[model samples]
Target: MKALVIGGGIAGLLAARVLTETCDDVVVLERDKLSDVPEPRAGVPQGRHVHGLLVRGGEIMEGLFPGLYDELVQAGAHLMDAGEMRILNPLGWVASTRTGLPLLVVSRPLLETHLRRRLTAKIVDDVHVTGLSFRGSTVDGVLTRNGRVDADLVVDASGRSSKLPSWLAEAGITVPEPDVVDSRTGYATRLYTAPPDFPVVIAESLSAPDTPRGGIVMRIEGDRLMVTAQGAGGDHPSREPEGFQEFLDSLRGPIAEMLTDAEPLTPVYLFARTASRRLAFEQTPGWPGGLVAVGDAVCVFNPVYGQGMTVAAMGALLFRRHQDFSAKGCRDFQRKVAKIAQGAWALSSNADQSWASEHHAPGPLKRAFGWYMKKWQVALTHDQDMFARFVRVVHLVDSPAALMNPVVFRRLAKYSRQDPRRGRRRAGSNPR
Candidate 1:
């Protein structure tokens, strides 16, 4: 089988590598001239900002490419035990417990470059996928600017801005209207050199009934730090140096002071128009055959949660299991992945909805669940088990249902009132 993967981002490249094992030949089509080294491209706008491969994401990447974790660490990616780091939940400080899995922190470019080198396939750059080359209901290949390339399957791993829906429509497939949850958020990121002892510090001012400002700082490759601050709605952060610092200070805690002392590396990179979008591809009854959509092309979540790469990896794994380059296989694959995407989409967007002035009232179930989850967040500040469970869901190692399981809830109920004063004292000692 020949596989033609559209978009050369992480999802496309990873899918190509996996498909190459089962297919006769694999080709990746990328619109932008992807950088061979660790650098930003026009396609991945979020590459200019901070990104972290959660513990679950790292594990999946390793499964795809053996020894990939060490390869990334040696390339300047920082691997930190989630337990050693301090985390502040909406309620308070999340208690530290050793989560055996470690998160990999690096610029998106470094990770992509490493993956590209390992895959050993020449990424066909500068070619834009214009449409599908199909025969009746079967997709034969993709029509690109360079011309047509024949294939048995065409996987649209294109990022969020994918034109596949339009292409499919032009090819005569009517897609269902996408489910869009706009957060109307903006992000500004800058690089800094921090104290060697305290490399990465994450401080968040979570969205509440009143405040909706948040920020994250992580130790990336090159011993540098990447800090990003986000404001809800049109609460945009200024691009000026002084104003940027002020924005950081306006965040909940010590991030402002820590950033003030760190050595500045790059200018502030600003990104706006962030919205959680989910395309209901599974609901399209007339969906075409031999064509599949993966990655952000299917669902784009708020990057603040850092779920994109991990979710994409999981989606690729799903494709391998459910899709066999057939039209019906494509439809089944979309439906299965859509179920996974909806869970993550709800998790992130529902959180975004909490920004009071933003005005997103979730349904009764979401509202009630959100209320309990907030209590769980408070429980996480004091209970190690709760923190572990919360992180498990955040990293997608476990399903959201796991957090709501009777086991976790029963534990939370048992421990919430056991020892508040003692918990605060112990948590206070461990400064991030």
Candidate 2:
């Protein structure tokens, strides 16, 4: 069978890798002329910002590309223990201890470079896909700028700007309106030369309603350090160097202090189009055969939570479980993709709802969840075990329900009532 995959980003690359298991001819069409080097592409502007694959995302990727982890580390990527990483929550610093789960800390460019090199599919760059091609109600292939390229299966992983909805509309089909939760998030990122003692991964928590500013500093491949400063509710981190440093100084923790010794290698780059949106394509009445949507084409998440890549990885993993390529098969997979994205969507969208968002109303349930999580952040300040459970949940390694168990609930009930910012419950020693 011949499969046509759109886009050459991580989602498309992973989907193409998965398809290679069943299809002999798997072709990935990328719009931009991909650089042989591990540099950011024009299409993926967010590539310039800080990024990390959740543990599950890293596992999914490593599974698709055997020995990929070792290869990355050899090329200067870091394999850091999750417990060793530090987080500054609104309440205080989360206690650190060994948790066994390791973080694969690498930049988007480095990760993409490795994945593309290891991918077994044919990657054709500079090919712009215009629309879908069909034969008697069945999807035959995708129509590109050059001409129609025929295929038995088509996967859309074209990212946030995907035109699948309009393409379907041209076929007399319609898709449901996307569920949106926009917090008006923006990011300002820069590369730097880390000091020898700089922490591998460190972040200041940025949730809505209280702390609208957050940032992370990560050491990636080539011994380089990447720092991303972010703000929600239109309080964007400034692109100018002076303003960027000012924004960093406004954070609650040591983000600014930690960077004092680091030398910047690049000017601050700004990215502003971050919103949590999920297109209900699975719920569409009539989905054609030989078609599937993955990654940002299906759902997009706030980068602040680091769920987009993981959710997309999870969606790619679904392809291996289903093999029916019929119209019903495609529809079934799409439905499953919706279910897969649900948890991450809940997290990002609900978190955004906690902000004063016009796109989503924080009904009682969302507001309550947000409140509990915020208080739980306070609780994490004093309890390492609780923080570990919360970390696993954030990494998609464990269920969110884990944080709501009786033990955690009982503890939070006792400790989370006081906000540390008020100087009331700040008894514990917060170690960096």
Candidate 3:
């Protein structure tokens, strides 16, 4: 068997990596020439922006490419307990405690470059894949700038700018309009020089309605640090130095002061396209055989949630664990992958929903859930157990359902009743 993967990003590379189990030949076609050095590329517009590797994502990647974590650390990636970082959410500050969940802090470019170096499959760079080539109703290969490349399976891992919709339409496949929920948030990132021991990271999330501005101070490879400032609901961070600093200053906490001591090495890079979108390819009638999609090609979450890379890893794992390899099995694969996308979509869209309530009319159940989550975030500030649960959920190690345990429900019920005007009051005070 042979597999062809288009768009040699993390998802595509992972697909190629996993297909090696059943396929003798697997080829990944990437548009831009992938860099050997750890630097941003044009292929990933948000490469310069802040990116994350959730705990579950790190676990999946490590399983796919063993020793990758150690290799990354050797290459200067920061590996630390997730709880060591100081986090400020909409409710209040999240207390720092050891939760044993590890965080791999590295630039998107650096992480990609390291992961690329480990791929055993042949990667053909500078190859622009235009569309999928089908044999009858089954996808057989891909049409590229050079020519058609044959394969038994084709996986579309192209990200936010995927053109699979047009390709499917050409094949007479009718797909419904995808669900799109935009956060309307934008962020600006800048690089700075820092010592090896940069201490702990400081982050303040973009709170909704009342406060929509936030930022983070974290370290990466090359003995450098990254400071990212963000503003949601159209209050965006600027690309210029003065404006970037001003934007940071406007956020709550010491988000702006975190950058005061650091020496700037790069100008601010601003990105505003932070919408959460999902494409229901699996639900479409007469889905094509011998074709599958993983990662942003199928769903894109608000990057603020940091779910993209982890969800992509999960999709890759699904492709590997799947038993069937024939064209007929492709339909099942798409559906299964859709489930993984759904789990992540709920988290991303729900967070953005709060900021988009004016445009959205969520049912009573959803509104109640959203209300509970806000209180839950506040609970994270005071309650250690709740904080741990929240951390695990965010890291993809635990499902959101875990936060709705009977014990937590009782605690939240009690906390909600106490004086609403209590300054900085937190939920889950009594762990009973």
Candidate 4:
């Protein structure tokens, strides 16, 4: 069997890798001529920013491509304890202790480059896919600018700017309208030479309802630190140096102080218009067979959560588990993919919604849940066990439902009676 994967990003590479297990020949079509080394490409705008592979994402990728973790680590990717990273949440600074969660901090380009090199499939760069070729109600191949590439399976692993919807429409398939939640968030990033013994610093500003601004400073490959300043609603980070510095200074943690003496390697790279979008491909009636979508082509999360790569990895893992690749199984597979993305989607969209002005007001139950979560956040500052559970959910290793456990509720109830301001004071005092 032959398979064709659209786009040569991380998602496409992983999709092609899994397809190789069943198909004899797999071809990846990338519009851009990929760089031979770790560098930014026009296709991935977010590539210029920071990226991290969560523990679950790393495990899934390693399962698909063995030795991948070691290869990246040997290539200068930092494998640090996630708990050791200095993180300030809306509730407070997360407790700093070993949580056994391994975080792989690497540049986006480096990870994609490694995955591209490892995949056994043939990657034909600069081939712009235009549409799909259909046989009756089933997709038979992809139509590219060069020519039609006939395949038994066609996977669209294209990023957020995918042309799949138009291509599917051309093939007489009408997909349902996508669910979109735009936070109108923007951010600016710059690369700098890392100082010795620098811990990862992330000062999150989502805690304040009036102002949603935050920043992250983490060491990536090449011994360089990537600092990103984020702004919610219309408070976008500036592309100019002075304004960017001001944005960083406004964050609730030590991110601004940490970068005071750092030497910059790259100019501020601005990425505005970060939104959470999910295509309802599974809900489309008469969904064609021999076609599938994964990664950002299916759902895109706000990058601040650092869930994009992990969610894409999870989608690829789903493809690996599904036995059927035909149109008959496409719907089922897509539905399963949507299900897998739900947790990340909720986590990201909910947070983004808080920054949205036109957001729908939560009902009684949701309001109650919100109240409990606010208390839970305060409790996370004092409760190491609860913080660990929150980290697990954030990494997609566990469900958000775990937060609603009776033990957690009891603990939150106990902490809710105390002065929440005291918890904030403790979190602010930690100078790690």
Candidate 5:
């Protein structure tokens, strides 16, 4: 069997790697010529910003590619202890305690480069995918600007700008209406040279009816600090240095002061295309066989949640587990991919809908979930065990149902009785 994988980013690379184990030939088609060194490229505009590997994502990647975790560490990726990092939850600053959940801090380009090198499949660069070649109701191959690349199976690992919908329509297939949740959030990132002892700090103010803003400062590989300031509801950070600093100053913490003396290594870079969108491909009737969509092509989470890479890795892991390339198996696999994306989708889209006008108003169930989540955040401020549980959920190691467990529900109920004013004061007390 032969498989043609599109896009050559993290998702495409992982898919190709998995296909090599099942198919006789696997070819990855990348539009851009990737760099030998770890550097930003035109393919991934968000590569310049801060990217992280959640605990579960790192574990899955390591499982798929042996020695990958250690390679990243040896290549200078910071292995962060969740307890060591300072985080400002919606209610207040979380007290630091070792949770043993390890996070890998590395640039997107660095991680992608490592994965690309580890893959044994053939990667053809500078080839743009135009459309799909279909035989009856099954995809026989992909059409490129250069020529047709025939294959037994075709996987779309293309990012958010994928044209698969239009291509599928041209092939006389009607897909389901996509679910979109726009956050209207933007990010401004700048690289700085930091002292060796600098600590990673993140301050997040949950989106409410009012505008939301946040900032993070973390040490990345090459002894550099990546500072990102985020804004939602048209309060985006600016591209100028002074404006970037002002944006940081406007966040609900001491992020601006923390960067006061850091030596700037790069000018502020702006990214504004943040919206959570999910394509319900599994719901499409008479969906073509031998075709699958993974990663951002199927669902794109708000980057703030840092779930994109992890979810992509999880999709590839799912593909590895299924190991069936038949038409019926492909459809079943797509359904499983949709299932795998549901948790991350809920986490990101619900948070985004708080301030985005373009998103549909939350119904009673969503509202109740949001209310409980805020209460859960408040409980996290006072409870270490709750914080650990929340971290696990965020990392995708545990299902969202874990948050609704009887024990958690009891604790949330107990914490809800505390004076709301006291929680507000506590949150306002620590600005750092």
Candidate 6:
């Protein structure tokens, strides 16, 4: 089989990597001329910001590219123990406890380049994929600036800026309508280099009643730190240095003090394309054969939650598992990938809706669910086991349905009664 993958981002590379297992010849078409070295690209503005591969996604990627994790570590990526990683919810501090999973902390561009290097297929960079070439009902190949190269299959792994729908329309296919959930959130990121032994702190605020400030500071490749400040709704972070420090000060505690003393390596890089969007390609009628979409082309989540890369890896894994490459294979692959994207879309948008307030009041279920989630967070603080269980859900290792487990609920209730004051503190406190 001959396969042509559009986009050379993490998702595009992942698709090519997996498809190579079945296709005899595979080629990746990338718009930007990616450097042999790991560096940011003009097309991926978000790559300038902080990013981390979640435990589940990290594991999947590691399996896909053996020894790549070690390469990243040697390249200066921090391997944080999942259990030891600190997280602050609306409730108080979530203690660092090991869950036996490790998170890969590296710059997004570095991660993408490192993953791409593992693929054996040819990557044609500096070429824009204008659209898909087709005949009758089959996708024959992709139209590029150079020309068209015929292929048996085409995979759209383009990120959030994908124009697959328009390409499909041009090819006589009716793309499905998309479901959008806009949060109007905004964030600013900057790089800092601290002393070799400076304290490593990762803090954030969960969107909740009363307070709204949140930030994350973690060690990335080299002696550098990636600090990102975020706000719910239209609350945008400052672009100036002084205003940036003030934003950190607005957080709970210690986070501000540490950031105040740390050294800044780069100016505050601001971006505001924060929204939860999911494409309903699986629902589209008369879908054409020999073509499929993956990655942000399929779903885009609020980066605040760090779901995009992880969900993209999961989508690629789904394709790998199914080993689908034909017309029927395209349909089945899209359906499965959509299911995976739905879980993440629901998790992020549901959380974002909670802070809508009068600006964007949610429907009945979302409002009700948010209320319960607040209590559940409090439960996590009082019960270490509950926190562990909940962390699995948060990391996408387990489903949200796991929260409904009877035993877990009972334990939370018992812990709350045993220490009401502590429970309240845990419930009300936000982690950095």
Better of 1 and 5 by TM-score: 5
TM-score of each: 0.93, 0.96, 0.95, 0.96, 0.96, 0.93
* Model 3 local distance difference test score: 0.81
lDDT of each: 0.78, 0.86, 0.81, 0.82, 0.83, 0.77
Write down the RMSD of all candidates, one decimal each: 2.6, 2.0, 3.3, 1.6, 1.8, 2.6
After TM-score superposition, the amount by which residue 229's alpha carbon in candidate 3 deviates from its true location, in angstroms, is 1.0
- lDDT string for model 5 (68-109, tens) is 878987997878776556777656676556789887877888
Q: Which parts of model 1 are misplaced by more than 4 Å?
A: 356-360, 414-432
Model 2 quality (TM-score): 0.96
What's the residue-level lDDT of 65 in candidate 3?
92
Q: Alpha carbon lDDT of residue 431, candidate 6? A: 45
Top candidate on lDDT is: 2
lDDT leaderboard ranking: 2, 5, 4, 3, 1, 6
Using lDDT as the yardstick, the better of models 1 and 4 is 4
Model 1 C-alpha lDDT per residue in residues 94-181, reported as the tens digit of each score: 7777888687777899999888888855478899888898888898988877788888888899988899889878977888888676
How far does residue 414 in candidate 2 sit from its true spot (Å)?
A: 2.5
Return model 1's CA RMSD, one decimal: 2.6
Model 5 misplaced regions, further than 4 Å: 359-361, 424-432
Model 2, runs deviating above 4 Å: 359-361, 417-431
Candidates 1 and 6, the one with greater lDDT:
1
